[model samples]
Target: MIPDATLAALFAAAVAARENAHAPYSRFHVGAAVLSESGAIHAGCNVEVASFPEGWCAETTAIGKLVSAGEKSIRAVVVVAEGDRLTTPCGGCRQRLAEFAAPDTPVHVGGPDGIRRVFTVGELLPASFELEEQP
Candidate 1:
């Protein structure tokens, strides 16, 4: 289980990032934060473009920042959005996260109110593709 303080910090960062998301096309702003093994938190928001598929997910952006900072291991993750339902990472993000996060790494999903659900990397993608598993 993630510590209360760490969870709070992640949530705050995700929410703040969501507020700055550039989603003029979809108007569906989303933010994500990842806690690295070294205890550093990285946050990023979704960016939408007119080209649709070219835009990246919030988790992808956060992971990019984490990797750019030289952190390769993820301890936990938090995602926040402005809807009543929970907003978890997409399939591609699940794979991206699995690249750096262990199977047991916790992924917290939150709405405007607060966290609503928690899932592990394995739970989200039981058969996540791994390069090492390839023939």
Candidate 2:
């Protein structure tokens, strides 16, 4: 579990980022934030494109921010969306997250009210594909 302060910060950042989502087509805005191992928080909002499947998810964008900053590990993640169900990361985003997140990394899904559910990445994506570590 992440520290209370960190969790709060992540949620706040994700909420703030939702305002910038470029979803003219779907109009389903989403935002996500990741807490890096170095204590930095990276936030991203979903960007949509005219071409279907070309758009990227909020989680992927957040991971992009973390990677762009030279961070290789994610400590925790928070996803916020306006919907009846909790805004969990998609399968592709889950796999992308798994690349940098440990099995125990916390994944929080939130609705308009607040966080509705939380799960470890491993729990969400059981038996994730992992390459053998090379020495």
Candidate 3:
């Protein structure tokens, strides 16, 4: 298990990114922060559009940044929602996260004290989605 400090930092980064969320349609803001094995932190917010499908998930954005930064894998992630609810990564984002993060990787959902949640990729996404696979 990773230290509490690491999860705390990731949550803080997620909150910062949430401020950048652009959800004009649903008005649901979201943020995500991904941690790489090399200790680089990448943050992203949901970018929505009228076309809908054109918008990107916060997790995907963070993953894109991580990839651009030459990260081969993700160690952990934190997600935050605008409201004080137990918001988690959407299904698509879960699949994407499973691509890079191990099943045991940590994922923290930030919200009001009573609404916060935390789960692993396996817990959120379950099993049997193809990402990069072992030979």
Candidate 4:
């Protein structure tokens, strides 16, 4: 389990990033923050373009930043969005996260008020596809 303080910090980062989301079409702003194995936190907001299906999810952006920074593993993640129900990562984002985060990695879902739910990567993506490492 992630420490309370660490979770709080991730939540705050995610919330702050959410403010910059560009979702003029869907109007569904979302933010995601990832805690890398190096103890660095990276945050990103959803970016939607005029062309449908060309936009990227918050998790995708966060993962991209993590990889660009030379981080290969994720310790934890938090996603924040405002809605009646908790907004967890979509299917594609879940797969994207699983590429870097272990099955036991914590994935927290939050709303405007506060965190609403916490799930493991395995829980969200059971039987996920994994590539075999080459020696």
Best by TM-score: 4
Local distance difference test, each candidate: 0.94, 0.92, 0.84, 0.93
Distance (Å) between predicted and true CA of 69, model 4?
0.9
lDDT of 1 by residue, 1-135 (tens): 789999999999999999999999889999999999999999999999999879999999999999999989999999999878878899999999999999999999998689999999999999998876566
User: Candidate 1: where are CA atoms >4 Å away?
Assistant: 133-135
Q: Any runs in candidate 4 off by more than 4 Å, and if so which?
A: none
Model 2 C-alpha lDDT per residue in residues 1-135, reported as the tens digit of each score: 788988999999999898899999999999999999999999999999999879999999999999999999999999999979776889999999999999899999996578889999998888778889999
Stretches of model 3 off by over 4 angstroms after superposition: 112-115, 131-135
TM-score of candidate 3 against the unseen true structure: 0.89
Residue pairs clashing, model 1: none
Tell me each candidate's TM-score. 0.96, 0.95, 0.89, 0.97
The CA lDDT at 73 in model 1 is 98
Residues 1-135, candidate 3: write the lDDT tens digits: 667787777878888888889899988888899999998889999999999789998888999999999997989888888665578888989999988899998888876232276799999988747746579
Task: State model 3's lDDT.
Answer: 0.84
> Model 2: runs farther than 4 Å from truth?
none
- Cα-based RMSD of the predictions, in order? 1.8, 1.1, 2.2, 0.8
